[model samples]
Target: MSATFNFTFDDIPNLERKVAIVTGGNSGLGEVIARELARKGCKVYIASRSHSRAEAAIARIREDIGTDENLAFLELDLETMKGAVMAAKFFMKLETRLDILVANAGLGGIKSELTPEGYERNFGVKHLGHFAFVSTLLPLIQQTADGNVDSDVRIVIMSSKSYENSHPIDFDNVRTTYHSWFAFLTLREMLQRYSRSKLANLYFMRELADLVKDRKNIYVNACHPGLVYTHIFDLSTSPLPWYMQLVGQLEAKLLGINVNDGVKTALFLAADRRVVDKNIKGILMYPGPTDGFVYFSNIYIRTINKLGLDDEARKQLWRFSEAALEKA
Candidate 1:
């Protein structure tokens, strides 16, 4: 695909007054995004599951960015819907407005399991947790938009290009039937579940953008961070086929982009003035490595269409998410 717009952290304007939250900010792409925002003078709250990890990330980010005042940690565990709700409440209690909300935390490549909320582990944490968190904080995001005339209030969901592989979500089978099996079969199931959750992220982003379209000042978008080397895969923790492990190592060594490069599209959607100027919303962004341009292409459009994603599907997912949260 051709590059459409060239963007980088250099294009991010001063964010001294902005307040942002990045889920899973303790490591990987989330940490990269948080550090960049902190560097740009934004107050960044690193929300994740572990207190120690989040604290360490905050400390490291503060040291790296040379400012400690705006970096803080808020405990969040997305495996449970209640944890997401509590995180939202905690943020609302502490911050008056939210300038950026990045749903960047996710997990993949694991054995089949169900969360306490009775959803597939991958779908529960990566999609539903963020869904609940965003639903609770959306009012504050809208309020931020209402008060800020000079900047756009943004929500960025970190989806993956693997979303292209997802089948249309089968709500009834979201908690997939489990069977103990060999490493390769388990790995395949894990990836399939992860793909489904990423697809859910896209559906949620599209529906959310539509829901908030009338606000005029709030912008919502999702992005696919091209393959990058990170610790999300732990072969020691979850066994993988020997050949699959070899392939993963080769891909990481040769083809994977650095985490810094992986985060460009998310940073663009969060802080780029063009997003607000062009009123870009509900679109999926893909950042090209060659020119650092973020664009929407026909292939992505065709993929979404082939996946059978429509307004009705989006709305159904929303309802299912809300009902699931209530039950949880």
Candidate 2:
């Protein structure tokens, strides 16, 4: 992996008239990303399921930036296609253009519980929900791009390095807890399913870029924050072997990079000029020690092998997603 220039929050440029939406922006890395975008003079909508939490985050951001004009909350629930669609429509009614859409909401370290929509929780929110959200919003995104040749419309999907650990995604297993028994048997099952969802995120980015390839102003990307500590780890730690559980408990409480560092790659994908300069679209970006990304050889290697998606897999994912959205 070739190491390039490092990045920090200061690297994000001014966004005086830009508009951005970050899902799960009420807390964790999402909150940080939303806050930074707001600070840089962008109109930011923190799309979240909890209005109260989003309000609190907004207040904190206001305190940090000494301004509230750029921050607002949009209701969003990523567990169902209906909610995702409704949220996108709502945003569209509120704003004519969208500069950035960060599909950053996700489930982490969860057991084999299904969503209210009867899909696996990880896959439902992380993949299917964002799929619906982006699909509904694509027209507006494309419109913004078409409205200006210089417009840099960005769609950032948050995948994970754990994608390398995923089992081959079995479409049959996504709609229910077909792995519930196995999930109860070992921690690997939980991680496997979660990683499977991240892989699904990658596949979504893969196909979306292809869908918009001719649209020079639009960029679609998926990325992982590397090993960053987030509270979701507590949920699945109990299922681990006792020794690994001990380590996981400690790590969950005190491990990984700081939340500030974790947000860099996403921010880079969102606001960095290098992305547009290099045409960095449809790639899985992972963090390096300090900043920017580690340039891996398989950046576009979406073959069915270990790390990314095959064309058939990407097609199947899109087809299933389109069918599911229609069903919803």
Candidate 2 at 47: error in angstroms? 0.5
- TM-score of each model, paired residue for residue: 0.92, 0.90
Best candidate, TM-score: 1
Residue range 227-279, candidate 1, lDDT tens digits: 77677754444456667767776766466766777887899889988887777
Q: What 10-residue stretch in candidate 2 is worst by lDDT? A: 294-303
Reference-based lDDT, residue 57, model 2:
94
lDDT of 1 at 308: 31
lDDT of 2 at 24: 93
Segments in model 1 whose C-alpha atoms lie over 4 Å from true places: 1-3, 180-182, 289-305
